[model samples]
Target chain A: MTGAIKSQSGRLTEAEAIERAKQGDGEAFEVLYNLHKRRVYSLCLRMTANTAQAEDLTQEAFLQLFRKIGTFRGESAFSTWLHRMAVNVVLMHLRKKGLPVVPLEDTMETDEDTTKKEPGAQDASLAGAVDRLELQRAVEALPPGYRSIFVLHDVEGFEHNEIAEMVGCSIGNSKSQLHKARLKLRDALKKHRAEKAKR
Target chain B: MNCAEFQKALPEFAEPQRDTALQAHLRSCSDCSLLVSDLDSIVAAAPSLAASEDPNPQIWLQLEAALKNEGLIRQPAAPLLVPPPQEGRGWRLSWALPVAAAVALTIGLLVYRPSTHQNLQSTGKTAVTEPAAAVQTAAATNAGINEDQDLLEVVGTQSPTMRAEYAANLKDVNAYIRDAEDAAKANPDDEQAQESVMNAYEQRSMLYEMAMDRSLP
Candidate 1:
């Protein structure tokens, strides 16, 4: 048996921590939980839009992370691996509740109502003009598919192909979803701006 | 290009690619140009979330209790590794039964994985591909052996700016290291947790080395 790790002198690496967690090191598992809880919670919050649910899911994700720590083959980045697990957990939870993971076909339209003004074509009334927080709220208001695409592409910096693989959509569909998501955000921002102007 | 074509290409507008027809359309069409600019801002204004806000700390206790419920990491604290968290003693190691198992595992990893050794040798110089085992062995090798002098050698090699950045980030690193220490020293009977501690250290070393190596000309 190898001696104690002499914690004072040596720094912990993620790989070492994961191996320890797999061996049932509760403290090592705690470190892993601390390391990733925020991102996991943030993802849950974005997906669920409920802080309590997000917190619950974050806890659930870590619990699952520790349980499944042994199966981690080290093929991908731990962050990627953990995020993927979190996404799967969120998706699974959403499915179990019968919530919509993808929006209806009608919602896929960039502008469902032709009569409504084109949010993108309007200068000074959209995008940069909108409050940052308002824009984020607008994002929060997006449909499941739109929100996931937007978060994965813009906020999370994933490639379209990666997004497609993650969400099980075609690459073209991913692009179209992003476009629609942006359009929705722009429309919401435009409305916020108009309302602000009136005030 | 027409409005749809221009809009489709908007995501790539950040790249300097000129389309004569697209340029002509943008030049003549106010609506198209406005839309293009709007799309650009939508992309630009997105908040790159890093989970900046730490989650509630109670989750740690919850997680630990849950592990205990599952029969993991429920070991009695070893005699040698009982440094309290409030002690502010910097980095420390917890030697326990699970940690001993992890040492064996680390040795097994080192012996079984030869490529990892080669990868460790030139860590900062090249991109380290196999992060799992390779990072663990490399990081663990340096840890606990020479402690202060070794850290100086690694940190000392970095550029001043990099060293400053390392100093700034050390608090978090120390915290992480502290977590590993607490687990191993306190109650790492569950070899899983001990293994995780060792892997975390390896990854930290790889990151530290990678950061330091980047500053080299």
Candidate 2:
């Protein structure tokens, strides 16, 4: 009841596990990390596309989390609080390297002749109406802003207000981005389906 | 509301409150129905992307090491939507005890009383008690001794510029004292000359030491 129990129990009734971890209990913090790392890492991966950069961003995000965890209050759900932190970490990493801003135009129209050059070109012959792989490829191929908004809103289930605050934009901007994301996703799925038809 | 507004509100509709008008539209409009189905699929596929698994064990190790090092429970760069006020409270709280202790110590030192002592060697003075005379003599001698010790300490520790200034000032005072002694030998029983010479020497010594002390980093 001294270390681990104190932190876990203390978090529920007295303070949160995150709060306790900030006070210096490594184990208590580990529990909090385990709970959120998957979603955080996934967001980083989808944002970066490359495994190495995603891993680096994920690690940096968690490191920053620990460095600044003392600032967290239970005003928002812990996951929501962590999501804002995670997204900022990825965005900052992208900004630092001057990575191309994923344009907002939706690029929904892919040239038919260039279809075979897409990442999932080999999967064109695979048989399925809609699968996770197809959806993931579609999401990943989305412009960064729309992909991020789509993932945060539809995939991660954040509200537009939360997305707006995290992404540094207005709620109106978030909704517009989500609409663009959805339309792009819908187009990609349509193209995917059309490709299936030709095979 | 028309289908466009209804569709915009459809995402919001999932949260247990679906407007009656939107529900009515959903029942009638095939387009809205398809939109709902499309949203359902998007939502379904959304979690699968979330299916990106936990990081490798090494990353957990690194994260744990990082948290332990930083004493952090969550990410630090972006604060939560609502940051905790406890951190500010804690920051302010940290200074309270140290400040209180410093104030107490300063007060205690300021109010401290030194012990009394007597002098048997004082030549009889009118109203001054033997003990008071001894105390005054002791204080004067101690002051002179402390000044000399302070000068030596400063010489040992001060930077070269300060040391050179101090050494030069000390030589000038010594020379002035020598000149005053020569004058005193030449003209004995001149109280004014003796007093001025003594005062000049004491003031010079004090200035040299203070300058030395000031020059220390």
Candidate 3:
């Protein structure tokens, strides 16, 4: 077991904490959990749109991290590694529940349809039109496959290649899914705005 | 450039440089321009959503209990201190861990058959078999150790992320099986001892099956 080492701020650096955690230090594990829990939970919440399920998934992700922390060779940033694990955990749960993470037919769309104008493409631009809360609600209402892609690409800032690897789709499919997700979200925001005007 | 051509190339425009044809289309077409603007705004606003929100504090407590139950951590003489949740909602410790183990064990015992091994190997895809069955059958018959070694070799070929965890878990389960087997041998007449040995083998079989599933591409 490695001794606890602290930086000038008198707190254990993430590296030191990881080392201690690998040794099964409970406090070190807690430290790592606290550091990453909110982000992991937020990811789960966005993907599932259910707080309780997100919480459960968050717990499961951390448990997995603890079990595998000894294997952390630091090849990538810890957050990146953890997020990948978190994403896999959520994806596996969704898969077990029989939800489509990415529909094969959607990914197989011809280039012509992929580039064709979406319905109501002439609507006012969503630039500055939708607020954060409304956008979030709209995101929650998206189909499971679209929501997963949108959240991973747009919200989580993963590259198309990374998203493809994580979700088991081709890079082209990831991009197409993200674009379609945006188009759907645009339609949703426009509908919300129209409803607000009626009110 | 027509709307179709411009939109076809739009995803590439996300990069800093935009070609003159796409630019010219954006200049002439209001709808295409608005589509670009809207997509950009959506992309811009997306990052704000990444701002982290804390989960309920009880989650850590529940997680701690689970880790302890798995023998992954030492039990402290006293409960570790943590801040209380703002609400008085009582959290229940889940029986999922034990229940899942029991289910896996049942599956392992039910699926074990000696004949399936040759079929699995013939396909060159042992992972395709029901994990518990493949593992339980392997562990039960004369070729148990060699089959497990072969499974471990397959596991070794998996990606790094899956490999370490599988190795660690298999090591733990193997130790558990040894302990149970020794207990049964030391008390041959005890039905409880015999049952413990059976349960331990079941657990080992399930763990091997889990490893196989994870090893799949």
Candidate 4:
């Protein structure tokens, strides 16, 4: 084991982490897992919504990370490469379940001038306190495909190009979906507030 | 730029270096500003899922087991060395054991008659036949080992991105196999591709099995 395999932190460098992982160092892998597990799990959870499925997805991603770590070339950041892997794992799960990839029927065609809608009684009354919880629910309510792009770009702060690669779509497609997602979310939140006001 | 274009670019605007024009407009445009605020709240409220909180830890346990599974461990397969099967002179000299000498007449009748059916059966037992294919495969493996240089050279040669991509590609291939299998089951009319798909799956599964076997504790 070269010292390069173990960086100054006694953990392997990214390159060495990959090399050692390929050599089947479960401990070294545990180190790699420790480094990225949270981010991986976060992506899985936000993408899938269901905790149970997210857990399974997270495990599968790491097992895959273990099985396929040998092929990780350091062209991009290891996290960037792994982000692609993690995203693929989620997409594969959705595809297996026959979940919709892109809701083509939803073309952001709603004509309602959402800006004209008033904030609802609930949103108006509780205001900022429950706003966080409501916002969380609204995001969770977005379509899976839209939610994923929304989470990656809006929440995780990945660039469109990066999201494009991670989601296996063209850069233009990522941007469009993001635009559509933002529109739909704004519409949904506006509707939620209006419906609450009517109550 | 159009509002649609500008709207899509709002995320990019969240960057510290937003274009001055967009920043100025967003400051005054309540709709766009509220949209940014709403996006901000949504992002701030984004749920954080920790794998540690998962109810079933068995998957990790299985993974640890898989890792610890004697099969996954990288044990240097001590070269399959046959100690030349201890050749002895007793079987050579007497052609038998002490009991065989005592039963000399029976041995003679079985061994001496070259044309006899009984003699053929007895001779077959003494001859140990090795498989040609097995021998050839062993030879090929030996040649492969000779071709490979030291471990470091082989490891050093592979780029890290290649390794990660290789892992990812295998995953993609595995997923394809899974999809093909599902397709085959759903629409058996595509029998030709189905068989080919199944065969590829079997081959890949064998590779996984072999890896698992090698890595097992």
TM-score of each: 0.59, 0.48, 0.61, 0.50
Model 2 stretches with alpha carbons more than 4 Å out:
A1-20, A99-130, A197-199, B1-36, B64-217
Better of 2 and 3 by TM-score: 3
lDDT of 4 by residue, B76-140 (tens): 32221212224652222222222222232232223222334234346783233224323533453
lDDT value, residue B102 of candidate 1: 48
Docking class of 2: incorrect
Candidate 4, which segments miss by more than 4 Å at Cα? Answer: A1-17, A103-108, A111-135, A165-170, A183-199, B1-32, B43-56, B67-70, B75-217
List model 1 lDDT by residue over A1-199, tens digit each. 1212324334345677788777776546645665576678767877777667777778888888777778899897888878878878887787788776555555435443522465444445463543344555677788776787777777767788887776677777777667777877777777766765776
lDDT of 1 at B103: 58
Candidate chain B TM-scores, in order:
0.29, 0.28, 0.33, 0.28
Interface RMSD over true interface Cα atoms for each candidate: 6.3, 17.7, 8.6, 8.9
lDDT (0-100) at residue B128 of candidate 1?
47
lDDT of 4 by residue, A68-129 (tens): 77777767678777777888899889878877544343465542332334544212222232
What order do you get sorting by TM-score, best first? 3, 1, 4, 2
lDDT of each: 0.58, 0.55, 0.66, 0.52
In what order do the candidates fall by DockQ, top score first? 3, 1, 2, 4
Clashes of each: 44, 7, 0, 28
| RMSD list, candidates in order | 18.2, 33.6, 21.0, 22.8
Whichever of 1 and 3 has more DockQ, that candidate is: 3
Worst 10 residues of 1 chain A by lDDT: A1-10
Q: Just chain B of model 4: what TM-score?
A: 0.28
Per-residue lDDT of model 3, residues B27-97, tens digit only: 88888888788777777777766733446556776897888887666633122111132353111101222
